[model samples]
Each structure stands twice: as C-alpha cells, then as structure tokens.
Target: MAEVDLSVQRYSAEVIAHRHAHHQLVLPVEGALSLSVGGRELRAAGLSGVLVPGEARHAFAAPDPNRFLVIDVPLAAAESLGAAPWIERAAGGPIALDGAAALLVRAAAVELDAGGSAALRRQWAGLLVLTLAERAARAPGREPAKLGRALRYIEEHAHEPLTVAEVAARAELSPGHLHHLFRAVLGTTVQERVAELRLARATELLSRTDLGIAEIALRCGYADQSCLTRSLRRRHGVTPAALRRAARAARPAGPGRGGG
Candidate 1:
C-alpha cells in the first residue's frame, strides 16, 4: 500500500525549482503563493491549490508570509485517483476545495496532531485522499449546466426537508432524468447525493456548534434526534455525542490559521 505525507508549513521569499518523487497537492491556507509550472504561472490563495505530478519541474515563490497545507501522495495511490492524478492548474478552478473540503481538512489536521496510533493517522490520511480524489474525478470545471445547477441547489437547500422530485423540479428536470444525470456525472443517485449533503451539514454542525442533538437533527433534515443518531452510527460508526466529543477535543486552543 502507498502512503501520504501531510504537513503544514509557512514560507516567504523563496525561489526554488524542484521536483518531487511523490505527487504533491499544495493548498494555500493564508496569504498567497505563485508557482511557475509547465510553462504556466499559477497563483493560489485562500482555499485554492495545485496538484503537481511526480518529477514535474516547478518553481515557486511566496513573497510574503504564506501558510499552506501540503500532502504528498505516493505514486501507486495517485494512480488510483482516477484519470490524471496531477492537476496542472487549480487556481479558482473546479479542483479547488469548497467549504466541505475545508471541513475535512480541519478534521484531518486534528487527527494528525492527535498523537494517536499510526493506524488512526493513516486512516485519516486515506480518507482525505479519497475525498480529494472524488472531487478531482468529478472535474466540476467540466460539469454540465443542468448538473451544476442541481448540485448547487442541493448544497444550498439540504437543510430543508427535500425529495428527489422537488430537487429535480428545482433543477428543471424530471425526477428520473435527474437520477440519471446524478449517476452519470457524480457516480451516485440523487437521493444519495442529498443524503451526503445532509450528513455533511450534520457533521459540520456537530463539530463546530453547541446546538442540541434534536435541533441539529431538525436543521439537518432528520425527523428527530434518534434518526440522526442512527444515521451517524450507520455511516460513521459513531454516535452524535461521540462525534461531538471527538470534535471538541480536537479543536485547537486559541485562534489558528493554516491552508486547506
């Protein structure tokens, strides 16, 4: 099995041209950095990032204070990430991490700093890679207009009680057609996608807020606290209370800043 090396680093005023043996994903957390790669100049700031293939020639510069989360994925693991694992340009592109990805990054960071068993760290890294791979594979830069609209609708409205028919209507497509569209584009069903969005919302609430379980459940489109508990355990092998505990424990003391 391949491995992932994860770290957060800050740099300033560096002019270096180098190639790595492992594929690299550089996510800018704070400030900005410019990379000249493959005869193209890419600048990443905030949640933007760039993926560099192994052995690619690249030079980078961060003129001011910049923080970035870097992940190096082994060749075998990169190959398993679908099509092309290396993304030439990710600045303001669909390959960029959204809010959901940001949440995962924070969770992964906590896991890395937990000083737990190696297996736990590896699991977190693996999951992080899997999510990036999935997002990359979607290639949202090339998404069809209809599918894009549908996805946006789900993201914005997952908190409400929703159904495939309602979502399909909002997307201006029939329920059956929307199902096909989701399966063809996202490799999942409409219902599954909605469930993912809802669960993601629930996870965010659980980890970041002090809301009660029942209120969180209602806000996440679940009927009640029991429903949320069952769903969380079924999918994450943890109850809402347990997840909250882990999340609160993982939180850093005082304000902190880092790249995604």
Candidate 2:
C-alpha cells in the first residue's frame, strides 16, 4: 500500500517553518489560515487551500481559531504534480482549491475519520492526486493565462460597449487570436459571449429590479429599448416586457398581495 496520511487539524498560533518528505495539501474548512511558501504568503480563506510539494519549506499561521484538513502523499505518488510543485501564493490570487478539488478533499477527510479500509484510502488518494494534476496543468501561469485574463475582463466590463478588438488589446492578444481562443476554449465567439452576458444582466434587472426597459438596455450595453427587445427575442424567444411579465407571474403571491 502507498503512503498517504490524512488528518484534520486546528491551529491558533504560528507553526515553525518545516519541510515535509511527502507532498502536502491543506484545505481550509473554517476561519482562515496563512501559508508561507517560496518566500511568499498565501491567505487561505473560505473554501481555499494550498498544495505544497514534498521537501518544500513552508509555514502556517492562524491569528484566530483556524481549522483545516491536511493530506500527505508520498513522493512517488506525487509524480502527478509535475515539474511545478508550489502553486502561486498571492494573498488574493486565484490559487485556491477548485470545486472538484474541494469536493475530493472533503470526501477524503470524511473517509479518514471513518477509519475506512486501506484500499479506500488509496482510491481517494489517487483521485486527489489526479485532480491536483488537472489543476496544475491549467494553472494560471500556463498557456491559457491570457484567456483567463480575457474572461475576467468580460465579466468585469460586459456592461460597457466592449468590442473584440478592445478586449483583445486588454488581454494582450490580437483580435483574431482572441476570437480563436474564445471559440476554442469556451466554445463561443467573442460577440456571442458579450451578448449573452448582456442578456443575463437584463434578465437580472427584469427579475429583481423595477428598472424600465430603456434604462436596463442602456445599463446592459444595448443601444436602446428596441435593441434590447430584439436581442431578448433572439435569445429568449420573448421581448423584454414579455419576459418581465412572465417573471412577475412566476413569482409567488407574497403576503403583500393579500387584499386588505
């Protein structure tokens, strides 16, 4: 059986710098913890954690009560981590655990506490390794880094009059290259994505706010009410007014709806 160690730990103070002979994964469940790796500090909060490769010098500190799950995998089993072992550790960086990784880590933690069989531990450990390998392959510093930048730009600037050329310049790629990456990685063209984002925003306004269609159109990057109506009809098979009416009808009759 391979060497794999899993434990749930709580810390209130600082842990002296240390090096592990085996790779370690730390998953934060409650509170927050600070990890120091490669002369940098990483804040693991919410559902975020850190993966420190075997033989790497690292330390952890918890100003407040902190709880986390730590798993150790032998150097041989950690071959899947590839050449780069230490992930980026900026305080607010995107180095946190992905959804699949978080789920696997939590499941492994549960199995460890249940005193499961050795075979079960091996299986969970193997899965965890594979998931981490996938994350490492798509790490932000890799080939798709610019694509990630473009995605962030879209999410942040979708409400503006954004064009493919403008977004490509922001992402440091030519317009054609940006379009290619969008289609290849996201399976959608740049304009399609922007329009979809705008429509999504419009739907949110229609459902949550009483904003008029003309104002919502301006806010969602459409030229006017007609533009918004045309796009909504194309994408949702209904005009904005009709969609808003449907949304209003679907909402349950609240207590305020009672006749006095």
Candidate 3:
C-alpha cells in the first residue's frame, strides 16, 4: 500500500465480490461494468465510474471486448471518502463529471500501459478520487434512488435505440416520474442525457483509439458515421476526424521513437 496501483483490466461475466484493504476506483475505458459496492448496485461506463471505499465489498461483471481503468489507492490517500453516501451520490454520475473524467482516465491508461512512474500514477489517482469526493459533497441532497437506478439502466443501454418508457420501466418508475426526476434532479431530459452519453463515448473513442469512425458510430449507437458526425458537431462543434487529429497532436511524443 505504499503506492497507488493503476492498471487496465477486464472481468468475466461471472460475478465475484472483492474486499480489499485499499480503496479502488473502477472506471470504464471501453465498455460497461455492472457492480455493487456495499449492496449498492451500479454500473460503470464512459462517464459513470465507481469509487469503492477501503474494506468495502464490491462485486462486478462485464462483457467481453471491454476494458476498465482500475486504480487501487492506499487507504491513507482515500480515507476522506469513507463516509459519503456511496449509494445515493453515485446517481447523477456518468457521477456528474460530464466527459472530461473519462478522458482523463484514458490519458492515465496511456502512461500506465507504457510503464510510467509511480509519482505520476499517484497524482492521477488522487485527482480522480478527489473529484469524486468533491462532487458527492457538492450534490444538493439525497439522490432519489430511482434516479440512480434509471441512470444505471441508461448507462448500460444508451448505445441502443432508447426510449424514456424503456428507461422508466427499468427503473420501476412511470414515464412521467422519470421525466420529472430528470428535470428536477439532473435538469435534463432523458433523450438529451442519452445523447450526451453517446456523444461523450464517441468523443472518447475518437480521441483515444484508432478505431474507424463507422465502428465508433456503431459502438456509440449512432445510425452511421454521418449521424455521429452530426451529433459531435452539434454538441461539441467539431468533427470526428478533427477530434482525432487534435488528440494525436496533443499527445506527448513517445519514448524510443526519436533520436536517442
């Protein structure tokens, strides 16, 4: 526990519970994860991340072709988060980070995979934990349990043709209640949230991976590359190609690639 441990990992579909002496941050780099932290069921995907306190019981499962950035932080650095509402506060996630948190995890992954140093890894992990804690503290009130449930359903299914009715049913709420919940709690409509999720994922894939636009479109649930292009342009005012190019340019040149 002298250092924060960081790695990209995947899990089998079979559920398994893990309890560790160290706190853990489970964020998706590519796909979704169904996990429970201390009896609170949640899902982690692009912007939806899980923060597990030290010694808490957490179990998870995910589909194939998925990757997650798992950070194991020593309890000392993470102790400040021990008393937050792990269940309720996680509702608006996907926790209220917008798209930046997911991108940050991807950046950390690059350095980690290349065997970067411990100091940098600790900084990345600390920033992530601090953000999660701060947001939870800033949340207005106890998050409606149904809202959290609806968010989980959406994170797991937003890539498909989604409907408010479907999401409401999954959360065991009426469509009207779901609508009101989104407006009251999140201040956005269900469709908009789903769209935000899709586009956020599209942005991550375009900027991080070398995958083709069409494939990225499919993964993000767009009808085609053009649809994804339209959404990206409308929301972020950029094209997929331009996003990719900028990401590549901003990335630091890798070692062993230039003159020694």
Candidate 4:
C-alpha cells in the first residue's frame, strides 16, 4: 500500500475547493462543515466528516473557523470502509464520528504533526482506519456477525499459522465467502491479516529476543527465513535484518533478554 499523509486543517467560513491526488478524509473537530463533491451536498455536524475519492472535485465551507483533521490516504485504504453498503451509499456523505472516533482522529493529527517517523505514522494510520471501520460497522442497518467473527479470529490466533481456509471454517463459511466478507468489512484479505499478525510478532521478537531470523520465522509460522523475509518486506517495506539492527540499537544495555 502507498503511504498516507495526515494533517489537521483549520478552515474559515469561506468555501474551499480543490482536487487531490489521493482520497481525502475531512473530519471536523468542532462546528459544522458542508461539502459539495461530484454534485452531492453533504453536511457534517458535531463529530463527523466526509470522504472524497482521489481526483474527485470537492468543495467545503464552515460556519466559522472550524478545526478538522485531513487524511490523504491511498485509494486502497478506503476499500475497507467501502465494503459496507451504508458507507458505499454514503460515499460522498459525511460520516458521523462519535466520541471514540473523534478522539482517534485528534490523536492521529497530533502524531502526524509531531514529525513522527514513518513507522509511527503507519501505526497511527492503522488505528485511525480501525476506528473508522468500527464506526462504519455500527451505522444503521449494518450486520455485525461476519465482521465480529473475523476480528475475533485474528486477535485469538495471531500467533498461529493462519490461512484463509482455516479462518473461513471458523466462521462456518467458504473461503470465497470469507474473502468477500473481509473485503467488505476490513478492506483486506485473511492472508493480509495473517501477514500483519506475523509481522507484529516479528517486531516484538526483534526488540526483545536473542533469537536468529530463522528461529523467529519458525516461531511466527513462516516456512523458513526467506518466507518470513518476503512477508515482512511486503507488509512493512523493511527487512528483518534491518529491523533487528534498529531494535538492538534502541534497546538499553542489559543482561536479561528474552523472546516470546
């Protein structure tokens, strides 16, 4: 996936119009903002915002100087949210953020503004995406069973060698069915989820262990060191060796060390 740019923008009462190279999320922190995009007029009041697709012509206006968080994410990032019919229908609509979502957006904006590293930005973006996904699932007339099950499975067996067939069986659905569900509910596949889990475990191992790359790979369910390297590079754009070196440098000098 491509990198996303997150920033906080304060808009005055006047109308602002522009097109972006990537999809944009305009989340209002205070007051209300109205957006016009592709002939659709949407209003976001309280804790809410609008999502505009890449290269889509859009305009916004606020009743006063309103504070908002602007997230410019790749189109692929929006796929997860777009899985919900309501979200799809509300494509150019303002999504109401509630307290949790509002807090997450605020934190994301702060982290982006702090000039954090790429890794931190990626972590924060994941959080923000998750928050939005939860809100999208709770929208009126949305079903939660499939999404609930998938999330539960990912959390419970993140350490195991997870596969699409296995997770689909857990949900009592076919692999194809699960694929559709994941695309609709999470904007990614079961394979991606498992890779994410493995990569997360790899990070922990790198920081806290004396284990070699091959050992870590075996523990994380990769067939071998090469497999682990491929998955990690695909997911994080970094190799295990580099990550291990960085983690080692960051660790304090100590006698006791471990891996989980």
Candidate 5:
C-alpha cells in the first residue's frame, strides 16, 4: 500500500529545485517563499499553499526563516483515494486555503513536531488535502474577508502580548462573534491559534538561529524564559536548550547567522 508522509519542513535562502514521482503540498504557516512550479511563479505565504503534481519540477526559496507542513502523497495513494486529490481537482497552482484549512494545517504541523504517530498524520494529510481543495473551490466572496485580515493580524503581532479581544478588534468583530467564527470555521479557539503561532516561532528560532534561549522566548511573546521552557516542555517534550542542541548536532559546526 502506498503511504502518506507528513512533516514540518524548512527551506534555506538558496533556491533548490527538484521533482518527485509523487505529489507534494507545501502549506506555509510562517514566512514567505518564492516558488516556481513548472515555470509558474507563486508566493507561499499568508496562509497559502503550493501544489506540485507528480513529476512536476519545482523550485523554492525562502527570503526569511520559514515553516511549512509538507505532505508527500505517493502517486498510487493519490490514485487510490476515494476523492480525487487536490492536484487532480484543481489547476495545480497556489491553493487558496481558507482560514479553517490553514488552521488545520497549522494544527497538523504541531502534531508532527510533537512526534505524532504516522497513522494519525496520514489521517490529517487526507483531511488537509480535501479541505484545502474544497475551500479553494468555494466562491471567493463566501470566504469571510475579515478572517483573512484576522489571520494576517495574528501573524504580524504574534510576538507581542495579545488577546482575543484585541484580535477581534483588529478584525472588526465582537469577541463573541470572533469566538464563534473560530470554532465554527477554524475548529479552534483564538487562544489555541495564538499559542500555536508562538510555539511555532519559538521552535523555528530554536532550531535555526544562534540566538539565546531567553531572547527567543521574549521574541515569541512568552512571558519569560521559564514560561517558554514550560510551554515547550508541555507541548514539544523538549526544552529550548535541548532543541537547539539537537539542531546543532544535526548540522555541521560553522559560522552562524540569525534567521528570521
């Protein structure tokens, strides 16, 4: 049986090009990337996605540090799925992921980072492909314009102390309406999304930069270093120090520069 692989991946500043026999989906949770798929230029950011059909050559480069929930769907698996995969359903370009679909991808990234089981991730991969594709097909006006603004607001201000009310205010919605929308559309609460963004940034900085753990914590909106450490321990099962140590061990020692 063909298997689905799900993982959180990062790309360097270098533009790397490759092709595979299977389809791939790149869901951006953080920074942007310039992607070239079959000579079509696309931007992977602001809760957007890039769909690479089987054997379609693609190249991507990140201008800053980034994180993406990458799904590798084998050709046989795509062909075998009950529903046609997104690549088959859509025109094969940037997938217009709605607020909920983007949140789902973010949630899956959290699970993958925390060593979620392969069986569980495979389940998520299928849902993600379907949701993104379905959402992409919906009439553009049906998508709440405020939701996109809300998500972009959260991304821009995630580093500062935030509140649901503040985010709702930015999105021009009442707190109650914001909560309702988040639950009904995104299947998550605002608090969960805030924490997810904070932790994701914390992890990205931990793994990719030479910054101190305490500073990384401050930058990610944690109250302090211990707050950050406890959150990481609770969610990711590791401390910032341990995460950085692991990251360092995985790479060759050399001159280091900070990445966004």
Candidate 6:
C-alpha cells in the first residue's frame, strides 16, 4: 500500500481546486475556510475543515492567510478505513475539533515537517484517523445498539482476556449474530475490533509506562511478548522496543516514576 502523505500548506485568499488523485483532508489551523463539493458549499472555522475525495470536484476559499494540515491519502486507502465515510459526512459541516484532535493534528503536522521516518508519519496518521472517528461518533444520532455494546465491551475488557464469544454474550446475541452485526454496521468483524482495542491499549502502555514488554502484553491480553510484538509491528510498522524508545524520548523530562 502507498503511504499517506501529510504536510502543511499556507493558503491566501483565493479559490483553489486540488486535482491530485487522492483523498484530502484540509484542517485549518488559523483562519476559516470554505469548501465547495458538487456545488455544495461548506464553511469551516479555524479548528475545522473539509474532506475531499479524489476526483470529487472540490474547491476551497479562504478569507485570509490560513494554515492547514493537508492530509493526502490514496482513495483506496481511505476506503479501507471503514470509518472514513463517517468522517466525510461529519465534514459536510464545520467540525469543531476539541483539544485532543487539535493536539494530534498539530503533532502530525510537526512530525511531517520534521522529515521523520515513514513509520512515524504513519503512526501520527493513525492517531489522526482515530481522533476523527471519535468526533464523528459523537456527532448526533445515537450509535447502533450492537455497535455501542461492542465498543463498551472492548473498552471494559481491553486489559483483560477477551473473546468474540464473550463480547457477544455481553450484547445478548450469539457469536455468529454478533459477527454479522459487526460486519454490516462497522464494516469489520468482532475479532478485528477486539484486536484493534487491544493494540490501542498496548500503545498507551508502551507510551505511558515503563512496564516490560512481556508484562504489557499479558496485561493487554496477549499470550506472550512475541505475540504482542508481532501484532504491534504489523499495525504500527515498528517494534515494541522502538515504540518504547520513541515514547521515552517524546515524554517530558522528569524523574523516574514508579507504577503504571
């Protein structure tokens, strides 16, 4: 798969159409921006912007000098993201990114400009997508019951032993039924979702604690360190040791801390 390109660009007061054959996410950091897609105009404030799919016939207008984090992802890559459409729908209107999204985008732009390795860039992109998905889920209507149940179960059991059958039981459905619901509603299987949750928890542990890899793996419900390393490398393109080192370097200067 082609890697997603992330960069920052300054835009003046002009109408512009990007002809790149990739999905673009324009997140304004300073001034407001107006976007027109299929003759539908959507205005976003400083903290929000628009998502334009490749060949989607879109144009942007900024009233003043503005800075935006331009995320260029292949169309296939965007579609592979099961939550991308939800983000597109949310982008139809101004997206008010709270502190977390703002922080993540800022970090992403910094990482991009610093000429960090591709692995670093991809990690930040994943964080950006996750933050966007969180915002989309909070948009308006209630989430589907099964989806909500699944998410809740994952959250509660992320650091414990978990299985699709156990989660299905929590949702009051058979495992097969849960699998179908997850595929239809979330565009992924229950096992995939559980793996994602477990990985996310592992990421937090790697970043926030000095726990040994084996301990972290066991805490995150992995059978052993090798299993955690394999899954983490596949998902983040880096080994657990590298992740720990990166986190330690990125962490603020402080004295040694004890406990998780």
* Maximum-lDDT candidate: 5
Clashing pairs for predicted structure model 6, backbone only: none
Score candidate 1 by lDDT.
0.66
TM-score per candidate, in order?
0.52, 0.49, 0.59, 0.47, 0.58, 0.48
| Runs off by more than 4 Å, candidate 2 | 80-94, 138-141, 144-260
Candidate 3, which ten residues in sequence have the lowest lDDT sum?
A: 251-260
For residues 1-260, could you state the per-residue lDDT of candidate 5 as single tens digits? 88767878877777788878778888887666788888888767654577777788888788566678888878677656643544565435665454567778889988988999989999998888666655433323433556656766776788897899999998888999878776665667778877877887788788778888889999999989999999999987998899889976875443222111
In the predicted model 3, the residue pairs found to clash are 47-94, 48-94, 93-96
For model 5, what is the C-alpha lDDT against the true structure? 0.73
In candidate 3, what are the lDDT values of residues 71-176, reduced to their tens digit? 7766554544452344234422335444555567888888888987878777777676665555445434443556767887888788999999999998788899
Off by over 4 Å in 6: 91-93, 138-260
- Candidate 4 backbone overlaps, count: 1
Worst lDDT window (10 residues) for model 1?
86-95
Q: Residue 94 of candidate 2: its Cα lDDT?
A: 28
After best superposition, candidate 6 residue 253: deviation in angstroms? Answer: 35
lDDT of 1 by residue, 1-260 (tens): 77776776565565778777776777655456777766666655544467766777877777655556677777776556542333333322223455566667767666655664667655655666677666545534434455655765776677787789988887788898888666654567767666765676687678767999899999989989999899889989999999999978976554333322
Give per-residue lDDT, candidate 2, residue 176. 91
Candidate 3 achieves a global lDDT of 0.70
- Candidate 2, 72-105: lDDT as tens digits: 7776555444423433321123233434455666
- The global C-alpha lDDT for each of the candidates, from Candidate 1 onward, is 0.66, 0.64, 0.70, 0.64, 0.73, 0.65
lDDT of 6 by residue, 143-222 (tens): 34454556556655766777788988887778887776665545567676667657766876787678898999998889
Clash tally for model 5: 0
Residue 235 displacement in candidate 3 (angstroms) = 7.0
